[model samples]
Target: MPSMVLLAEYVSINGTDLSDYCRKAELTTKVEEKDVTTYGSAGWKELRGGLKSGELALEFLQDVSASALDSIMWPLLGTVVTFEVRTDQAVVGTSNPKYTGSVLINGWNPIQGSVGDEAKTSVSYPTSGAVSRATA
Candidate 1:
């Protein structure tokens, strides 16, 4: 049997819950492929896995409050920060099917629009190390 996990679950950054302000979030992992095709080999190309990398993207309703801007901006502008994504809308650490890791803030963009539009921010970062996955 197979089960589905909803996207409207828990999400946190540096142990702080940000699900309320978060509109979209995604974590992607990829591996670099190295071509290993050599002479006297088959006509088809061959590849070998080289390195692994990860990236995270988040979209949030822009807020200028201390907890919203100050908290996130400082880390994004300063150093690597930890983030966690859970399967349920509970406290981060208390939930299952979680992914946690540290990442360096790569880019941040605050968007502003005319009337009848909500302000938002989009940020993305590249993972520095392994992103641990937990299912229980």
Candidate 2:
């Protein structure tokens, strides 16, 4: 297998493509671990998968101008919105699988940095439903 470099990542939220302002994007899915240790004379513990959940984290180069990053995200602070992310902006296929799901916009940091620092924002949102990966 070959390694992949993240030069052009695709990120979309609520039908809006925000790839230009996004610097980093990540999607993670996991299942809850449930223990079911029985009285089977075995001294080992057994585990099972339970609930499934996911989360999406993004880092953006802030652009607070009119109709820019701030304006677009501020209005979606308290809602569940759809999102999609891929390794590259090119057509989705075996090399570039797309991850799509809904995330709850539970938090935001419009301004947080020191003087003379570059404007940027990092946020993590919990998924509201199933996260699917497809290549088409």
Candidate 3:
């Protein structure tokens, strides 16, 4: 399969670096793919090698400017939903010819999803069930 490094930290992205959105985090603090199953699927792991791992050239961003981007990618990801997408058999990005490190989305949102199986999102525990998914 593919390999990826998911470092969740506060990050600023500029339109130029959209392809390779780097994660800013302490090397000691890492979220392994195995642990992610508690929330989402393992498919997201490939992101590490494509660009986050410093493998390919990427466009870096400093702020969230929606109109400036070729497209709006953030909206695609459910506010807090996860979906298991149908991927190729092998390590898709590595073996495939077209690869850059950008997370592909459906128009503006992510093609996969943000929550559990089939993208039925759960309320954020932090908000006391106040947070919910917005369908477009």
lDDT of each: 0.78, 0.94, 0.26
Tens digit of per-residue lDDT, candidate 2, span 13-123: 998999999999989899999999988939889999999999999999899999999899999999999999999999999999999999999998999789998999999
Of the candidates numbered 2 and 3, which has the greater lDDT value?
2
TM-score of 3: 0.18
Candidate 2 lands at a TM-score of: 0.97
Best by lDDT: 2
Model 3: per-residue lDDT, tens digit, 1-136? 9695443222212223232333222211122233223235445433321211211112223234465333443554333222111112233243322222222222232233445534211111111112111211
Candidate 1: what lDDT? 0.78
Model 1, span 1-136: residue lDDT tens: 9786676766787778888888888899999999999885668888999999998888888887776754566556647889887767754453457898998876666555678888877778898899988764
**For model 3, how many clashes?**
15
Candidate 1: segments with Cα more than 4 A from true spot: 1-7, 69-71, 90-96
lDDT of 3 at 133: 19
The TM-score values for the models, in the order shown, are 0.81, 0.97, 0.18
